[model samples]
Target: MSINNDDITPSKDNEIREPMYGMSINENPKERNPNSSNKLLGVFYGIGMNVNTIIGSGIVTTPGIIWNLVKSPIVVLLLWFVGGIVSMAGSLSYVELGVIHKISGGETKYLQTAYPQPRIMMSYLFSFMHIFAIRPGIISAVLQSAAQYFWYTLKEHQYDDGIDINTNGWKLPFTPFWYVKLLAIAFLLIITAYHMFNTRWAIYINQTLAVIKLITYSIIAIAGIYRLFADWPTSRTNWQNSLNGNSDITAYSASILLITFSYDGWNSLNYSLDEFRKPEKKLIFSNSISVGIVILVYLLINIAFISVVPAEAILDNDKSSYETIAVVFFYKLFGQSPVTVRIFTALVVLSVIGTAATGIWSLFGVHLLSYSLEVIRYRNKGNLKKEKNDKELNEKSDRSSKIEYEVSLFFVGIFILAGLFILIFSFMVHVECPNYNPNCSLREKRIEQMSPMLISYGFLIIALLFYLFYYCLDTLKRQREAKIIRIADK
Candidate 1:
C-alpha cells in the first residue's frame, strides 16, 4: 500500500518486496500492483473508463452508416440498443476471465490467462491485427481525425482569408511542405507526455476530460432532440426493406462493424487490473455501469442526430452525416454560422481525441508490463545475472524499465504520426466529410463508391482477415499441444 522507498533499495534482502520493474515481477504481483495509480472511486472509475472507452471516434461518423443500413430513425435507435446488449455481453464474458487471469492484455490477456503458455502465443498472434493492425490503425485513425479538425480550426482561424473548406492545408505549421508532419509530431508529443508523466495523472486527466466531453455531448444531444420534435421532419417513408436488407449476415455484420469501434473500450476497466480496489467486484461493476451510461449517451446522441436531421439526410451524408446534420440542426435553431459549425466540430473532435489518447495509453501499459515482466521474472541463462552485484540490481532494473517505457512511448508516438501521415497520403483516410458540394444535390453515394470510407474499410477488412487467419491457425496448434500436454500429465 505504501511506496516503501526504504525497502526498495538495492539491498539483497529488499529484492523480494520490489515490483517487477523493481525486480519485483518475481516478487509476487498478487502483493504488488505495478500500475495502481489511485484507489478509483467505484462509480467514477467505471465512468472514467466508460468515458475513456466509449464515446470513441466512431460516434460522429457511424450514424450515416447505420442510417444507410436501416433508414428509419426508430430502427437506428433500436439497432444501437442491440449493439449495446452485445457489447455488454462481451464485457461480462471478460469479467469472469479477467478475474481469473489477472493479467494485463485485456481481451487477449484474458485468453492467455485461460490457456497460459501455448494459448497465450496463439492469442497474441491472432491479436497481431488487434495489436499490430486494429488497435494501432484505429487509434491512429482517431488522432489523425482530430489532427484534421485541429488543422481545420487553425486553417479557419489562422488564415486571414475565408476558408476554401475543400482545399485545406492539412500540413503542420500550416505550410505546404511539412505542415502535416508538424501537426503529427505535436500530437505524438502530447500523447507521449501524458502517458510518460504517470498512469495516475494520465487516468485522472482522462477522467476529467471524459466528464467534460460527456457534458458537451449531452448538450448537443439535447439540442438535437429539441430541434427534432420542435419541428419534426414533415416527410417520412417506409424504407425498412432497404435499410436492414433481408440477409441476416449483412444485417449483423453491418451492426457489428459500426458499433464495435464505439463499444471497443468496454474492457478499459480490465486493462488496469492491478489498479482497482477490489478487482472482482469493481471490474464487472465498473464495466456494466459505464457501458450502461454509454448506451444511454450513444442512444441519446443518435436520437438527437436523427431527430433534428431526417434519416434520408443522415443516410445521404453529402457533407458528412455528422457535420451536415449538426449544420442543419444548428442552422434551423441557432443559425449555423461558420463559427457555430466550427465549434460543434471542435466538440466532436475533442471527444474523439480523448478516446484515442486513453486507448493508446492502455496499449502502452500492456507493452510496458509485458516487457517489465520479461526483464525481471524470467531471467535468461545467457544474461549472466549470476554475477550481478546487489547494489546495482535495483538501479539497473529501474534504468532498463524506464528505457523500455520511453521506447514504447516513442513507437506509440511514431505510430500515431505514421498512421496519420499514411491516411493523409492515402487520400484522406484519416479525414473525410460527406461530399457536401453545394453544386451537386444528390447527397448519398453507394457503399462501394465513397472513396475514403471504402479505403479505410478495405484496410479494416484486410486487418480482420489477418486476425482471423493467424488466430485460427495459432489456436488450433495450441489446442493440439494442450491435448498432448494433458495426456503427458495423465
Candidate 2:
C-alpha cells in the first residue's frame, strides 16, 4: 500500500508555480527545491521598508523651498496632499505590474517583458538614466543636504559664527571644500560599511532611527499645536499673514516638483515584490498607509515650523537662508545656544543617512545590472566557441564565469567612479548656489536641482504610458495565439 513519492498527485504543497518573469515554469515537480528560504515578506516589513525609503532629506530641507514657492501655507499643504495621491496612483500601477510579472528588477523587467519583440531600447535607456543620472542624482542631492547641515553645525559650534550663506559662494567655512567632501565621503563609507558588516544591526539601527525621527517630528508638531492653542491671538495673526501672498503657475510647478521628489521613495517596495507574502493585499495597504502617514506628518511639521518661525523667516530674501530655516525655528524655540540647534540638525541628518543606507545595496545591485545584456552575450559567444572547437564547455564555462566575475568587478569600479563624479557635482552645485542664490551658476544649479524632478516624474509618466501601450499590445497577441490554438483543435 506504500506509494512512490513521484507518483503522488500534485497537491497544495507540491503544486508547480509559474516563473516570476513570464518565462515558462519548470512543471516537473522534481526540479523544485524544497529547502529554499525565498518566502514572501510580512506586512510590517514591507511597510517599514517603504516608509524608511520615502522619508529622507526632502522632508527636512525641502519644506522651506516649498514654502517659498507656494507662499500660502494652505496651498502648500494641498500640494503635498496631491503629491501623496500621485504617489499612491503610481504605486497601484506598479502593484499591477507585480501581480502580473511577480519578479524583481522593477521597471527594467516590466519593460523587457512587455516589449520582448522590439529592440528593448526603452528598457536599457531607463536603466541607463537610473544608473548614471537618476539614482546618483537623487543620492547626491540628499547627501548635499546632509553636507550642508553638517558644515552648518560644525561652524556653529567651533567658530561661534552661524553658517554664512554668502561667503565667496561656498557653503563651507574658510577651508571648507575638502572638509565637507571628506565628511560626505565618510558618511557614505560608514553607512555602507554598517550595512555590509552588521546587517542585523543595520536593520535595528534603521528602525531605531525611524522611531527617533517620528518622535522628534511628533514633538515638533505637538509643541507647535500647543503653542497655537495656547496663544490663539498670536497664532491667528500668523495664519492670516501666511495666506496673504500671491501664487503663480511657476510657483505651483516648483512646489509640485519638490513635493513629488520628496515622495519619490514611496514606491520602493515595488522593486522587491518577490519578498512580499501577499502583494495583492499587502501592496495596496502598505503603500496607502505609508503615504498617508507621510502626508499627515509633513503637514504637521510645516504647521509647527510656521508656528514657531514666521513665514518670511522661512522665505527670507536676505541674511538668513532657507537652508537653515529649521535651525532658526529651533533657535527661536530654544534660545541662542548652539547645542539644541546642533542636536536637531544631527537628528535630521541621521534620519536621511539611515534612509540612504537602507537602499544603497539595492541601488548598487541595480547599477551592476547595467552589464546584464553584455554578460548574456559573452556567455553565448563562449558557448559558440566551445561548440566550434568540439571542446567540453566545462572549461569554457569556467572561463566565461571568470570573465563574468571580472565584469562584475569592473562595474563596481564604475559605480565608485560615478559616485565620485556625483559627489563632485553635488559640491559644485552647493558652491555655485549655497543659499538658494538668485544669481548663481544658473546652469549647474538647474541641472543639480531639476535633474531629480525630471527623472522622478519623467520616469513615472513614461513607465505608466509604456505599461498601458504594451499591456494592450500583449493582450492582442495572446488573444490571436489562443484563437489559432482553438482552430487547430477544432
Candidate 3:
C-alpha cells in the first residue's frame, strides 16, 4: 500500500516550534482519526520491531565465530558491549533526526533535509543504494540462514531413530540443494504476501514473535545462570581464563565488525516514524527500551554460552555439525540428545524468520512507498513547470501528466519486483559448498564471481557519481532561472 504524501510529510501546523528533543506535539492536538483499514502502529510495535530485527541470527551464530577469531572470551564480550554502546548512540542520533524531520523514509528524508543544496541528489542516492542493494542483501542473507537452520533441524530429527542422515554436503538424498532454495523462497513469499494483505495482522504477528524471541533468550540466559551456579568450578575457570588466548589485532578488528552487524537493526524504527501513533514521545522511549533489552539479553546469553561451553571448545567446535554457538551451548548443557538440539535450532530458525519478516515488511511498506511517491511528485512538478508557457500544451498536460505518472509507477513496480526476484533466486541458486574440496570447480567458480559486498559498494559509488552529475545539472538549472529573472527585471 502507498503512503499518502500529506500523511507522512509534516504540515505547517506540525512544524517545529520548539527544541527538537523537547518538542511537544500536544499544543495543537488533533483528535485521533482512527482508520480501521490503515491503523497506525503504536510504541509497543515499535519496541517489538526493534527487538525482533536486532536479535536475529547474528547473536546465535557470531559468538562462536568471534571466539574463534579473537581466541578470547573477554575480548568477545567486550566487543559485544562496545557494539551495544555504539548502537545506542546511533539510536539517539536517529531519534533526534526523526524528531526534527517528523517524517518517514528514515535516512532518505534526513539526507534531503541535510543536503538540500544539491537538490534531491543525496536522497536519491540513499534510496538507490538502500532499495536496490542494502535492504535486499540483508533480507536474502537472513532468509538463506533461516533455510539452512530449518534444513539442519529437519535432518537432525530424521536421524532420531538411528538412521544416519548425512547433512555434510550441499545436496543430500532426502534434502537436495533445491529443497533449501525453495524453502527460502517459500519463506520470502509467505512473509511478503502476509504483509501485503494484512498490515495489522503482520504487526501483531511481529509483536508475538518479538515476545517469543525475548522468551527464548531469557530461557537461554536462565539456563546458563543455572549451569554456572550448579557448576561454579567450570564457569569460574572459563571466566578467569577469558583473556588467556591469542589476540590478533586483525582478528580483533574483524570481531568488532561482526558485533556491529549484530547491532544493525537498532535503528529500524526510524524507517517508519510516520506510521507511529505519537512519534515525538515514543521515539526515544521505544529505541532506548529495545536496545537496552537486546544489550542485556546478549550479554547474558554470551555468559550462558561461556558458562557451559569454554572458549577452547568454541574455537575447536566443528562448525559443520554445530552451525551456531547456541547449538554448542545446548549440546554441552543437555548432552548429545538430538531432540534437545533440534528444539534450540528450531528457535534459531524462528528468530531468523522474525528478522526477515520485519525487514521485508518495513522495506516494502515504507521505504519503497516513500521513494515511489517522491518520484511521482518530482515528475508532476516538472510537468507543471513545462505546461506554464504553452496554452495548448497546458490543456493536454493533465492527461499527459496522468499518463506519465502511471507509467512511472508501472516501471517502479516492475523494477522492485525484478530486484526482489533476482535477489531471492540468485542467492538461493549459488549454494556454498559446506566442505571445500580442491576438486570442486563449481565452488571455486562461485567464489570467483562478484561478491555481494563488492556489488553493494559499487552501487554506492555509482550513487555518489549520480549525485554529483545531478548536482551540476541542478546548479546550472538554478543559474539559468536566476539569469532569466534578472533579464525579465531589466
Candidate 4:
C-alpha cells in the first residue's frame, strides 16, 4: 500500500524519523546555517579573550599601591583573594545571563530583559554610559599605561649611561609629555587598524599574547618560590608578622576598591556571545576556567612578591622614583642591571598591549550598536515572521551599513577626544609646572579635578532621573490605551 506524505505525522513519542547530515537527531537543523560566515570562535578563544582582558596593567601596578595603603602583607593578600571571589561570582552570573540570551551586548541585553516596562530606558542608559565613557576610558587608560612603560624604559637607559656606555641604542628626542601622548596615539591607531581588518587574525594574535602572559607570570611565580626556598630564614621573617600594621579603615577600603578594579574585565566574554560557536554550552566552562586561572595566578604572584620583597621596602619605595611594583620586584630579584630592566619593561608593555587590543575587539565587534538597532526594529515591526523576501533582505543590508558607519564614527571620535584631552593636560602641566616636579601639588590637584569617577557619577544621576520620567509617561500611556479599548468594547 502507498502512503501519502500528508499522513506522515509525528509519533506519540515525538521521535525524529529523519536527520540531516552533520546534525544529531535531537538537534535543530535551523540553528546551524550553512551560508553564514565561517569565522565563529570556540571555547578556547573565549577563555583567551577573558584572560587577556582580566590581566591588564593592574596586576603589575596595584599590588604595590595596595601594600602601601594598607601597610600589611596579610591585608593585601586577603584583598586580592576577596576580589577574585567577587569577580568569580559576577562571572558566573554573567554566564547564566549569556546562556539565556545567547546574544551579545552583555549588560545592555540583561538590563533590557530585566526591565521592559520603560520601553528601552534601562538599556539606553547603560549603552550611553558604556559607549560614551566606560569603553573609551578603558582603551585610553591601557594605551596610556603602555606608553608610560615605553617612556620609562627610555628614561632608565638615558640615566644609566655609565652602566651601558658601550652599548648604542635608538632613543626619542622629545620630552616625556610629548613622547607619551604621541606614542599613545600611535598605539591606538595601530591597534584599531589591526582589529578593523582581518578579525580572525586579530583573535589569534590576542590568544597567543594571552598564552605569553600566562607563561610570564608563571616564570615570575617560580622565581619567587625558588627565592623563598633559597633563603628560608629571611623569607620566613617576611611573613612572620604579616598582620602587624596599621588598620585604618579608610586605607583598607581604598585598597579593596583598587583590587576590585583590577578584577574589572571578568565579564569580557559576555560581550561577544554571538561570535562563539556554542555559547550556551561553553559559556560556563569558559568563564569559570578563566576566572579560576586568574585567581590562582593572582594569589601566587602576590605570594611571590611578598617572598622576595620585604613589606618595608615596598612601602618605602619612593613612588616618584619607581615606575611600578613590578619594577621594584624585578630590580630586587635581578639587581639594577639595565638588561633586566629592559626585559621586564618589555613584558609589561606586551601585557598592556594585549589588554588594549582585546578591549578594542570586544567594544567594536558590531554587537553593541547592532543589538540596539535590532531591538528598535523588532519593536517597530511587532513580532514579524522571518522570511527571505527582497524587502526584508534590503532592510537588513541597510542596517548593516548603518551599523558599520556608526561603529567607525564612534571609534574615531573616542580616539580624537582622548588625544585632545592628552594635549590639553600636557599644556596645562607645561604651563603650571615648568620644572615637571613630581611633588608639585598643583599637578596632583589638577589630576584630582579631572577625575573620571565624578563625571561618571554625574551621568549616572542624570540617567536615573530620565528613567523615572520615562517610566511615568509609559505608565500613563498604557492606562489611556486600556481605557480607550474598554470604551470601544462597551
| Top-lDDT structure, candidate number | 3
Write the number of the candidate with greater TM-score, choosing between 1 and 3: 3
Ranking by lDDT: 3, 4, 2, 1
lDDT of each: 0.57, 0.61, 0.66, 0.65
**Can you write out model 1's per-residue Cα lDDT over 1-490, one digit (the tens) per residue?**
2122222312221233233346343354445655444453465656667666778767666765666654556777887886777667666665665555444556554444345554245445434445555677677766655665565555543221233434333422345224544565677678779878887788777777676678778887888667656664442232222343232334435544566666777777666665556555566677778788888988887867665555555444333434324444444455547687677667766776788878787776467554553455334312334334443455544543321111134434543553354344332112233354555322232322345456656766676676568669856976887689799999
Global fold similarity of model 4 (TM-score): 0.69
- Cα TM-score of candidate 1: 0.63
Residue 217's lDDT in candidate 2: 69
Which should have the higher lDDT, number 3 or number 4?
Answer: 3
Best-to-worst ranking by TM-score: 3, 4, 2, 1
Which candidate should be chosen as best, given TM-score against the real structure?
A: 3
TM-score of each: 0.63, 0.68, 0.71, 0.69
Per-residue lDDT over 269-382 for candidate 3, one digit per residue giving the tens place of the 0 to 100 score: 877765677665778788889898899989988888877885655644333332356766777877768898888878878878888888886675346544554544443332
**Ten-residue segment with the worst summed lDDT in candidate 2?**
1-10
Output the TM-score of candidate 2: 0.68
> Local error of candidate 2 at 32, Å?
8.0
For 1-490, candidate 4 gives per-residue lDDT tens digits of 0111111111112222211122332344345665434656678877877888998877776777677666667777888987787677677766766666555677776676577545767776887677667777877877777787776676763232232211212343345455677888998998888787887788788877777777778877898888889988988776776534454655565566567667778888877766677666777788889999899889888888778876666544333222266666677787858788778777777878888888887775335443544443434332233343334334433543321111134434543553354334332321122243455565454555445666877887887787688678767976887689799999
